[model samples]
Target: MILLVVGADRVDAGKTTFSTGLLERTGAVGYKPRAGNDFWFDHDDCRRALADGRLYGKDAARLSAAASRGRAPERLNPVHRLWQPSPDGGSGLLGRSDREFVVDRIGRDPEDALFVRNATAEVPDAVADALPLADAVSIETVAEFNDLTEREYVPAFDRLADEIEDTDVAVVESYSDIARPLSSLDPAQVAAVAAVEPGRVRIYSGDRYCRACEIASSSPRDGAIEKRVPDVLDYLDPLERVRLPPLDKEQRDDPARIARAYANAYDAFLDAAGRV
Candidate 1:
């Protein structure tokens, strides 16, 4: 088994897109290690999948369908953290403390509405059991752009790494850059990279010639992105590169084709890895 981590140069750079595409093409077991607390509530798709017996985070649902359907979303995304309103900001059952609010509430446990520490033990065995059964396994961390050093984040990352350590390909989303520097990443990012060590990192970015990409390419990380592109006959670095299509606005923003293009990019990745 090989672990193939799909990460973006920056957020929205298509990490999940590439992961889902690769899962489809490779028949890899998919695990979305870190998902938000309100994931199911926020995504109607996840609510639908869960209603049908498979519970998934937004990203996990897409991956489960594309790579291995029929498995429950809870199995795909076992470690989830809710981002509920802080207790001090609270009043209702979910927040409001009124009887009508209680009745109006979904009637689940009160603790369910709180953002608890990320506990790895929460990860069900079903995920571990399913991994070796596929061609490969792909794990997506929570959004990888924001608070990386938060104490709440590392346990889940450690847990995921331990879970998939033996697999042939381990594809992680955003942990690689955490160890860099504060100035390198966004502080208010909604996602965080897990701290799992990566064997190979493939930096995914859009076409440099694209207008939006050109602007994004102006950031500090963009300079890092530029340096990552090896010049002709340049010394081989450990990092491999995969460029996403220089899509028109429609194609670039289309969620469905995002997966398709990522699938296409994975083919290119395989060629680069010589896995082809």
Candidate 2:
């Protein structure tokens, strides 16, 4: 199984959307891999989190038959950190935390839990323990840096490298928007990361992508789509089924745009299924 780690220049480059897109492409559910109870969910949590509940009702139904594929979402996304929306917002363990929640407790296969993480250098130790070691791995690169400072991110990678220890090769998602002088990131260091895993693929959004997203925040023109998505859209062609940035926040709020993007992502899913 391949562990795909998605990233972007910063927050809105559509990591979640891209992860959703990849799941669609992979016939895998678009799960956060880190749904938690003071911890991320286990495979059973994903399965039990069926159509009966909120957003995942349909998903729970779809995944019901599958055995944790091989790992739990928590195992996939061992550690995470999210800032409270407002400074006063509560912040603690981001997702499900332990094997108990993932094992028979949540009620699914622990092995099949492959996770999708919006990783940074600063993930927690326990969370790192839970993540699956990739036979193959893919990392999405950022085009720009959001608020993360060189101070925080520089040491993060040291921690990240500690996780896998060593592997064959790790695919690096390349980017053009990141400015230099990032103490934490050294583009030159990509080769070293790749040294761990030599089999790699670099997915570019397009020969052309928006250098500047017109929407300050991704919002949709459609009423039902998500405000987090972009208005300009098109379905991904099968051969070009790689995930890209998601629609802006505004797009997530728009119903029509949300449907369109979801449909577009689904198209990629259909195409990918045909191959494997």
The global C-alpha lDDT for each of the candidates, from Candidate 1 onward, is: 0.36, 0.28
Worst 10 residues of 1 by lDDT: 99-108
| Model 2 residue 116 distance off true place after TM-score fit, in angstroms | 22
Give me the displacement of residue 69 in model 1, in angstroms.
5.0
Q: Candidate 2, residues 71-177: lDDT per residue as tens digits?
A: 33332232222211222332212221221111111112333322333332233344434444232122222322222213233344344343322432222221111
- Provide the TM-score for each candidate, comma-separated: 0.43, 0.26
Give the number of the best model, judged by lDDT.
1
